[model samples]
Target: MTVRTRLLDPAVARAMSAVSAAAKKGLGDPALAELVVIRASQLNHCAFCLDMHLGIARGHGVDERRLDLLAAWEEAEEVFDERERAALALTEAVTVLTDGFVPDDVYDRAAAHFDATRLAHLIGLIVAINNWNRVMVGRRIPPGGYTP
Candidate 1:
């Protein structure tokens, strides 16, 4: 597919950058953060993001096996820890909103694993990735073009 735009309008791009920077600062665990991003990108079917984030995730030392099983995280408890599972559950709940709004139980599970500050950061990361997914998908940004 042809690209629709090289970048979003300047104001929107700046806003997105700000959000991204804030999310990165808010979350401390690079590996966990990448998992959240990768999971959300997977759910959104954003190939550009998947390609980019997979590399970033690896750079953060996330395991190859975990990355391979991210799409099936629910069934791979042996590979994912409780914190990772909770984040994955939150990612699904937020990404698949049409399936239903995020359930309280899912939120509670994440809350149990993370304190309020980190929980907010996790939510921020989720929202930002979803936004990026929609923008890249809308632009038909090709996968494999991103370097990391």
Candidate 2:
């Protein structure tokens, strides 16, 4: 729990709350949102976000197996299906923000699973989590103190 700049102070918290409220309305499943957040946090090496999202995901009924295999999701035979995989891929692409935006093939794969509304929501979630990751990591937030 090394001291780091908190993203949500009394003033900034309001703005963050607005973003969270919108993400909640957009994201259909709390579990999926948590999963994407955790994965993106992991990619960004943001320990604060990883701990928070892991706790949130488990609270929403995500089990140990799926959590364990998340880093190596493609090689594992876990509970995630094609839709989840596609969303996960989207999460990666969005967080990385490299390779020239989200590729058409990735969008097509995700589109096959989610409707237009859900897709939009999913993208919003990805962007929000990635933004959090960038801020926390950039601020040099330390790990191992979080409960989850």
Candidate 3:
């Protein structure tokens, strides 16, 4: 498929990248944070993000089974811990927003697992990934386009 020309300003893209970096860093748990973004990309069907984050996650020593079972996280209770399940649930709730809102149960579960500051960073990370997913998918950017 032909990739569409990028319509977003270079500065805006740079800002978005910075937001993502900051959020990930602020979250302070590399393994959990990587999985959060990866799950968000999976839900949003962003191939470019999947390519970038999957490699990053693996590099950080995230389990192959966890990555493979991410899409079916709820059904793979044996693989993901309670904390991870909560994050993944929050990721999906934020990514889809099917009812135009995040369910209280999902938010509460995440809050129980993460303190207020980390919760905020987690939300920031989820929001950033969702936006990035939409932008990349809109531009038809392929998986291998991610350089780092």
Return the top candidate by lDDT. 3
* Model 3 RMSD vs true structure: 1.1
Model 2: per-residue lDDT, tens digit, 1-148? 4556755566665675577658857877888888788889889998888888788889999998899889887777457888889999888887886886888888899999989988988888888877777777877887556663
lDDT of each: 0.90, 0.81, 0.92
Q: Name the regions of candidate 2 deviating beyond 4 angstroms.
A: 1-4, 7-9, 144-148
**Model 3 alpha-carbon miss at residue 82, Å:** 0.6
Count clashing pairs, candidate 3.
Answer: 0
Q: What is the TM-score of each candidate against the true structure?
A: 0.94, 0.87, 0.95
What C-alpha RMSD separates each model from the true structure? 1.3, 2.4, 1.1
Report backbone clashes per prediction. 0, 0, 0
> What lDDT does model 1 reach?
0.90
Judged by TM-score relative to the true structure, which candidate is superior, 1 or 3?
3
Report the number of the highest-TM-score candidate: 3
Question: For model 3, how does the per-residue alpha-carbon lDDT over 1-148 read when each residue is reduced to its tens digit?
Answer: 8889657899999999999989988899999989999998988888989999999999899989889998899999999999999999999999989999999999999999999999999999999999999999999888885666
| Model 1, span 61-147: residue lDDT tens | 998999999999999989999998999999889999865699999999999999999899899989999999999999989888775
Ranking by TM-score: 3, 1, 2
Cand. 2 Cα-lDDT: 0.81
Task: Count clashing pairs, candidate 2.
Answer: 0
